[model samples]
Target: MSKNLEHQFSMLVREVRKEFVGNGPKEISTRFVGNWAISEMKGNLTNVEKFMISSEQGKQMVHEARTKMVKQIYKKAEVVNKFEALMGAKVLRMFSDINIDEDIAMTVFVFEQSIESKGK
Candidate 1:
């Protein structure tokens, strides 16, 4: 991607990710891989999240729950449309993962066309 488009994509990714997380992350970064936009977020855990994820079993449960939540969100056409609008491409797929213990998350949004191709 060109510098301008890269910057724009990064900014939009951060904004959208903040909305997804209910609040913005303490730190966030977005990168491109083929036609995919990969966003990573790190933040402090909410008290409820912290309390619920105290044990190893609890951590696994919370992580699975987070995965389910993201899958549900991606199932919505409106959500996909919103991302495509922001990303300037048709979205092909989305995948997300979270680490409950580290309070970190990674989400990848795949577009039908490469971002670099669009930039050129």
Candidate 2:
């Protein structure tokens, strides 16, 4: 995909995260590979979350909550529709994971067709 399209996708990801999670990552980079749009996000932890991760139990709880919350957010019809519209393809699946220690996250969207080709 072109750099412009990738940038748009990155912004869309950031916006979705901010809208649902109440805070967007400080930085995001997105790339198209095969039928997937993969995004790497940095600085996703809020001040409260940063403090919570200091305890082992708090760290586990935060990780579990964040992971489940992200999955549920992506499963929403509105979220799925927005991504499908942006990529011009049906969404097949979505995957997300976060590392509390590093305050980093990765979100991957799988489309029914190659999004790279659609961008051309």
Candidates' C-alpha lDDT = 0.74, 0.91
Q: Which residue pairs come into collision in candidate 1?
A: none
- Kindly report which residue pairs in candidate 2 clash with one another: none
lDDT of 1 at 90: 92
Model 2, TM vs. native = 0.96
Local accuracy of candidate 2 as per-residue lDDT tens digits, 1-120 = 477888989998889899999999999999898899999999999899999999999999999999999999999999889888887889999999999999999999999988876566
> What is the model-wide C-alpha lDDT for candidate 1?
0.74
Query: TM-score of model 1 relative to the true fold?
Result: 0.78
In model 2, what is the error at residue 94, expressed in angstroms? 0.6
Give the candidate number with the greatest TM-score.
2
Query: Model 1, residue 74: what's the lDDT?
Result: 76
Q: What would the per-residue lDDT of candidate 1 be over residues 1-120, giving only the tens digit for each residue?
A: 565666666666556555675655677777777798887878835567788888888788778877887778777787777778876789888888887767888888888988756665
